[model samples]
Target: MMINNARHSYVCPNCHSALEFQTKQVVCQNCKNTFPIDEYIPDFLLTNQEDGGEKLKNRASRFDDLSKVYESSNWGGSPRIVVWLLTRKIRYKAGIGLDVACGTGVVARSMAKKINYVYGVDISMGMVQKAFDLSQKNTINNISFARCDSENLPFGDNFFDFVSCSGALHAFPNAEKALKEMQRVLKTGGVLTIMALLQKNIHSVIDPTKRELKKSSTDEEIIEFNKAHSSMENLDVKLHRFTLAELKMITKKIGFNNFKYLKLGSVLIFSVER
Candidate 1:
């Protein structure tokens, strides 16, 4: 299937109006809000700095720092199986898809090669930029990147055939809101897949290390950490643990049915039809 490279699939976050594509930006004709295109990626974050600005900035900065090492890393094992599963779930190969919080576009790139065209959205400008750069370097044209909030996607309702959020749900500020946005953009009968890090994995791998560290820590070291950072409040990626039951409750409440899930090592995969 041929895609129109000139035409964009986006809407204004402020007014839900169609955006006109220009050379360096996409403008909303109705609201007259201009979203600048930096480094060839259209940015859709319209909220002011006061409204969750620091949180957004901190998330962006954290992922930006991760982008430096993202390409070299294996991205937590093979994503080929994930892409294969998604491609099989998709009814056809002609429709467009969305990848939310697509850090470095690993899964998006694989999906672009296997199935349909893809649009990858990330909160971090650095991650989006790296995704674009990698796409360009590899000559992959079917996938595009945008800087946007996952909790509030800037797209029309029922616009996507499939949506995939992999290994990033636990880090979202509001996981339920993000899931709702995913449901809102999905077409009826469309598939939504979320891959998250399970709490069991953390207990197995991380808890023992923490216990050892705590056993060895001096009183001064503990006091200094408490004085400087206080609680673990400012941690960039706070892993919000979830169980299978909790996931089922959220998915069912959001109007999704035909639920299916699987555990792939530390990653918990959930696939539901909207």
Candidate 2:
């Protein structure tokens, strides 16, 4: 496989300032923080669990987004299979690709051979740990799972050649901002494929009463949950719920070329090039 991971000069993970490399380690001359590079890739903020959401332990995922296709038994790998099914026709092999909100590298493990240097970034520790375990089991050395947020990725601009975000946009506080960042990391001719739930009256897809009841957990229970605030308000006000016209406007705004949109299940598959 072609080595696509950049060994470019790095910056402070904390402040994002230029860093000085010393003895296989990069240290922030300003922040005085240090990061080690094991097997060539710098472990910049790799161990930070702050990016990890609540560790779900062994309990089943109650609100799993991929429940329709994947059962409680399959875990993250199942969702990865779904992504492959959606975009198998497009060329992804040996291309640098990112699986955002890549919970436990489920979709990523399946995509490792299809892409070079698959970078799986997610905020959930439980997911990251699960992904890490799978990567080790599969011995997929080129795949790197980082504890990172979609809103604030550690990568530089124009880095990856391809990106895939499956069933992730709905969880974002600002989907448009996240989309722009995904676009920013891609090279001029790079490709992006995102799968997200259509906001067109979600009740039409999910039962209205069931969805509403899930939102009203007890106050004591709220403290236990990681995502306490609901993004429905933000979705209601600022979200561009995917009409064909709106989807076209978004891809245009994101600087994508030859954009195309397709519906898969209740999710919209936005495929475009940079």
Candidate 3:
């Protein structure tokens, strides 16, 4: 796997200045600050800052194992559906792309097959390492991985032709900041898609209603509980579900154009033009 030393495509997350890529690190031309390059993956994460930076990193380290447990559950089908939904939308085509919060690079790898180049960025180095390994093992030369924050992308403005955030938007500490950063890096007319599980308030109301119905022990009550449980089972600890209307309003607030929403299986897909 060749490391793309495209230094010009990235900038310093601190000073927002161009970077000079060295053998094992990058020097900020403006700030003169140096960031380490571990295993060819740039580390753009800051040590001390707000937004639960350290907490997010700690969680990321344990994410690989936790994700495996989740993926092995009955609700595991959601991951496959997420990949399929994103791949179908990306369509193996020629363009530069970015996958925010890309875990193990599954979607990014899939997009690499279709696009010219794809960059996958995640907050956790553990997840980024897994993604980097996937790229090398599969010999996908067009894809790269970096340990970086989504709300503070290192890439230049109007850099990518398309952007994607699948099944991870809900986990973002600041969804609006991350979404705005995504839009900032995307070129005008570029396409962006966000796939997530919308946590509906109706789910809360229905859950209690189902419990009440079950307490009655009537034949109809049992049926309602089963149905409600089936719907609730899809949720995970990391989920921050929002309705399609709520998400659309968010995209609108972010100034995204030509927004469209789709429901594929258990996930909601939001697409917009930058």
- Go through the candidates in order and give the clash count of each: 0, 3, 3
lDDT of 3 by residue, 1-274 (tens): 3456456567887667888988899888988867789888888875546874666566555554433322222112236666766666663378789999887787888888878988988876767787888788898888877777887888888988889998678767678899999998998888898887775433553456555654555564455445435533433334467778888888889989998777864568878888
* Candidate with the larger TM-score of 1 and 2: 1
In angstroms, give how far residue 15 of model 2 lies from its true place: 6.4
Worst 10 residues of 3 by lDDT: 69-78
The residue pairs in collision within model 1 are none
Off by over 4 Å in 1: 1-6, 74-78, 200-237
Write one digit per residue (lDDT tens) for candidate 2, span 57-161: 111132222222222221223354467754463475767777887766766776677766678866554455566667888788878765555766666678787
Off by over 4 Å in 2: 1-71, 74-81, 86-92, 200-244
Instruction: Output the TM-score of candidate 3.
Output: 0.78
User: TM-scores for all candidates?
Assistant: 0.82, 0.64, 0.78
Q: Which candidate has the top score in lDDT?
A: 1
Q: Could you tell which candidate, 2 or 3, scores higher by TM-score?
A: 3
